[model samples]
Target: MAKQTAKTTKRSLAVINTIQKLGGATLDELTGELEIARSTIHLHLQTLLEEGYLTKEGAVYHIGLRFLNHGEYARSRKKAYTLAKQTVTELSDRIDEEVEFVVENDNRGILVHESFHPDSHFPSKERHISTAPSSAGIYYYLHSVATGKAILAELPDERVEAVLDDRGLPRQTAHTITDQDDFIRELEQIRDRGVAFADEEYVDGLREVGRRVTGPDGSVLGAIAIIGPKYRFTDERYTTELPEILIEYVDDLETEISDSYLDDYR
Candidate 1:
């Protein structure tokens, strides 16, 4: 029984590794590479798909659209995914942390694109990145994240005040700035610094640093950030890392957005 379990785990990991290496693979390609029995390969693939790590399109087994939902949304922006992806890709490499593109949904900040760490530094022992966005209209408050601060920075004071009035600044942590007046001032600081910081504000032991994602005209479209656990992202590290990464990311996104706008004109 132990041998059977070991064999299954090996085959399962083999199937997963192939998909990871290729980004996507056909059933035939997998069968050729995996020395495991065909039944074993099929079983592992089924499990991977069921676990939301793999997706099959027609005959092509690929990483699922779950990972791309955010990218799709980021792509749908004025610039589209092509440009945003470059920034997203770079952010992941530079920081070795999860990087994402987020946008505003009604009154809430929504994650629209996400890029994961390379297999080397992944937090999960369960192979493959499974992060997916919570759908819109779910009522996550604006003060819940640094992502929110980035979104808020773009707002006119009156509009910002309105959102705050509707959603009181409930504290997520003692570190969270909940006072309306203080929060508004903090938003100004974010604008001046060109970044937003969540010092364990959203989730304790988790931290994120964000900057406003803008369209071609410098209109803030949403927010983007790099995220990780607190152990790896201490405040000092965040201050040193986030702003630089975010600034470069936003610059890349802007170029893509500009080109996308011009494509429409032509």
Candidate 2:
């Protein structure tokens, strides 16, 4: 009975995750994608709908907005997220560039906050900002982006190896480092310099500089990054100017987080 219950729970959660990834799914689509019997999929879907975890329109079922409440509550529990939002916003406005705060979860980087400069403009082809209401909640492979790499640099080598074992080094662009040894070397450089740079590694023509933030307890919190077009991120700015500014902002953010929370709290 215990084993059966566990299996059922896993299937139900899989149903929810599949619907989320598809944006919405019909009964047939869910059954086909999950390779479960139609009757089993229908049972799972109906249970989720009754529990208000899903909403149906016509033949399609979608992830319920109720998840928003849970997501927001989870985000609110993170003091760094709240503080980073304000810090990134101010930093973006000051630099007239885009800024992002991202945290590691399940070995993936989750964007917690993103801010865009008021006067910032990108060529249509180079626009990397999402059209969604907010770019928060998006996930990225830790090996792909500057902020993710910065956070990875702060993690222990064993943990980093475990993450790589799970996610592997999938190539995101021509410049992305797919070799594990090369990525490990890159992380060493980031640790030495206290910053990470993504030169069209995750997205074409976009460049970013990132620094990790730590709590008062010296635990890794997340990372902050400044982003812009390649033309704007010249060698001098990308390697020197922006990295220095990011380091300063992240240092200040770390101090504020430490001051605002008890040393034992985090």
- Candidate 2 lDDT, 16-124, residue by residue in tens: 9999888899998988899778999999999889988899999999998888899999888977789988999989988999899999998899988888675554553
* Model 2 lDDT at residue 234: 91
Model 1 worst lDDT window (10 residues)? 125-134
What are the lDDT figures for the candidates, one per model? 0.73, 0.88
> Estimated TM-score per prediction?
0.63, 0.92
Q: Give the per-residue lDDT of model 1 (tens digit) for 1-266.
A: 44446766777777877986776888888888878777778888888899787888888888765655754464565445456657777778877888777776767766556677863243431122233232222234677687788889888989888888877788766687887888888898998988888877766676778888777777777777787877788766878766786787787777778887888999
Q: Roughly what TM-score does model 2 have, to 2 decimal places? A: 0.92
The TM-score leader among the candidates is 2
lDDT (Cα) of model 1: 0.73
Model 2: residue 1 alpha-carbon error in angstroms: 21
RMSD of each: 13.6, 3.0
**Residue 29 lDDT, candidate 2, scale 0-100:** 90
